[model samples]
Target chain A: MEHTQEEIRKHVKIYISVFAALAALTVITVAVSYLDLPLAGAIALALIIATVKASLVAAFFMHLISEKQIIFWILLLTFAFFLVLLFIPAMTS
Target chain B: MSDMIRYISKPHPVTGVTNAKLGIWCFLASEVMLFGALFSAYILLRTGATEWPVGADLLNVPLATVNTLILIASSVTIVMSWASLAMKDLSRFRIYMGLTILLACAFLVVKGFEYGAKFEHHHFPNSSTFYAIYYTLTGLHGLHIVGGIVVNLYLLFPGSAMWQTEPERFLGRIECAGLYWHFVDLVWIFLFPVLYLL
Candidate 1:
């Protein structure tokens, strides 16, 4: 399970690049928010950008990309329940 | 027996991951539900309201932007700390972890100022649906930050002694903490736009 020196260096490089990407995306999110798009359009754009940023953090930073299948199953279940939670409002309405 | 401890520390034969990692993921699964419920409530409240103030008008975007950078910086440092330990560089690990804690503090201080400004303007949770959701969402997220700081501080200080005796387990613990910290930052990533920008 030990990482070679080269692997460690590679990871550090990836971390730095991910940091830069997250920061750049944040700036883009803020800039786009200022546009006078329709409300739904703005919300969709914002959430989409946020989702991309979240994916980066989860995949690279949290190492979820190479995680075990059990963990993915756990998250899939959580996502299912989360969808159910969101749909309750729509159903009621 | 030592085998039992080893079983917990090493990846399971079937799952190919350590017990600590499995436990943390399970805990995070529950956390997703907790926050998901609150977020669902938020969507319901916002959609149901007749009039809702634009979030940008009420919130301090510049301040939150700074806070977002701070959290992002901390997230990097936390992962770097774990990386340093993995590379057997304790000195660098200490430096990185210390920076992570300091950045976490900076985020809270800036957030406190934001809250203070709201109160000074007589904006409370009951001020409007916007303020109510703002305070609740940010407040809950702030509490998570505090929890992360507490765990990270323990590992950086008193709990660091474990590194000498059980480096692998110590690294695993830090990785778990980093996972939680990254999740906190992820929550804020969404929160920044949802609460501040949108």
Candidate 2:
């Protein structure tokens, strides 16, 4: 699909905003590592921040939010499989 | 009969995406599984261990933090390069794409230094379970980066000629490359915090 010049310019603004958010989140994650939290708490906080950062990149940079229905289906299946793989260790343990 | 390709310049009527777009996503789906399995392995190892080392203690967090920003910046540049094509500015596309490639190279150089330092300190993959997994995961990711650089270099130079003949198809190719590059960056988003910070 072709994007108009104006549309791309609009998207560019969002890209920059995402970049800033990502940069800030990166710093925050590192800073959180220095805190005196328990190991489990630290892991949760860091991963929560990281998941937010990953979502921004996927939604905006990868343009997955507006992507086609079929692609979403593919990703949905992939996510399902991902969940299954994640659960394997838990089940075995 | 002429040997020509279809679905390159335009979206397929059924799928609503060009062939390249669909193909790349499917490829990326497989990639997710590949990395996801490794991530699963990581969880298993960590949870089962009685004594796990702190990543920040053994690793260079500052260097990794810098690498994270570099990858994030490269992701933006890659997308901008695709946008530049949509704006019908080939030169702008080249500039952004070139910046993306250079930033990626800078990341590799920094990683090389990190790896070099590790070797100097005798932190080989066999040093411990930590070093082994660190090298395996990051080393595989590094290979992916090398693969991206090769594709991006082609698109930036010789492959760009297609832009003149088939602009839409060329744009599609850029979009695919951007998707791949962004996936690599996304992997790092997780790898950074999971490996270094936590």
Candidate 3:
């Protein structure tokens, strides 16, 4: 379906909100780093935070949530490639 | 208006142009694994160091931090470029995409300076395995940045009217490229502490 001009404007609003949230998350993650948390804890917290931020960007900004099944299959193939990467290192290590 | 849409709904998939995005994304996924292993190496080496190079003592964190922020800013610009295209503003699309490319070049220039400064201080990869992985990972990432800049330039030139005409197809390309760029930034986010801050 063709997007109405109003719908496009709404998307821009959502885009701005996602951008603001991502920026805030970056700042908060940096701030949290200064708390002297355990190394594992700090890293875990940062990864969790980054994952959430990336997800928002992916789902909305990248529109992955509305993508075609073929696109999803392509992404899955990429994920499978990542698994191969893990195996190479696992063997080498 | 609704009747206009009923006559022609979906456009045909533009052959390899559609595949181009998936191709880029696949290559990037492989890159993540490559960098992931190197980062894991960094972790192992960091723990093994008898005296971990005090971050403040060995490298210039301030410079690296600026580069990090530069990359993050570029990420936003890249997305904005894609957004402009989606809004069917080709001129705005060109402007933002060009700015993104410039910022990417700036990122590399800063990195080049960092490498030069390190070499001047005899901070070669042989300094330790830590430095080894450090240079290797960042160096590889640097090359990827160069590759990305070239891709963006290719997309911007007048010759790519196919991309210009059907901006949705180009949107997919930009989205894929942005993912790689953000991953580059994400790698740096982790690298900052491991290399400069911690």
State fnat for each of the candidate structures.
0.77, 0.87, 0.11
Model 1: CAPRI class: high
Candidates' RMSD to native: 1.3, 1.1, 5.7
The TM-scores of all predictions, comma-separated, are: 0.97, 0.98, 0.76
Q: Tens-digit lDDT track for model 2 on A1-93?
A: 977778889999999999999999999999989986998899899889989999999999999989999999999999999999999999999
lDDT of 1 by residue, A18-82 (tens): 99999999899999988889999999999999999999999999998778898999899989998
lDDT of 2 by residue, B131-168 (tens): 88899899989999999999999999999999999888
Candidate with top DockQ is 2
| Candidate number with greatest TM-score | 2
TM-score, B chain alone, candidates in order? 0.96, 0.97, 0.84
Per-residue CA lDDT of model 3 for A1-93, tens digit only, reads: 244556667776776777677667666766776677886786688778767766776676556766666657766876676566546545555
Q: What is the TM-score of chain B in candidate 1?
A: 0.96
lDDT of candidate 3 over B50-82, digit per residue (tens): 766655467776677677667766777777776
Candidate 2 regions with alpha-carbon error over 4 angstroms:
B1-5
lDDT (C-alpha) at residue B70 in model 1: 92
Candidate structures ordered by DockQ, highest first: 2, 1, 3
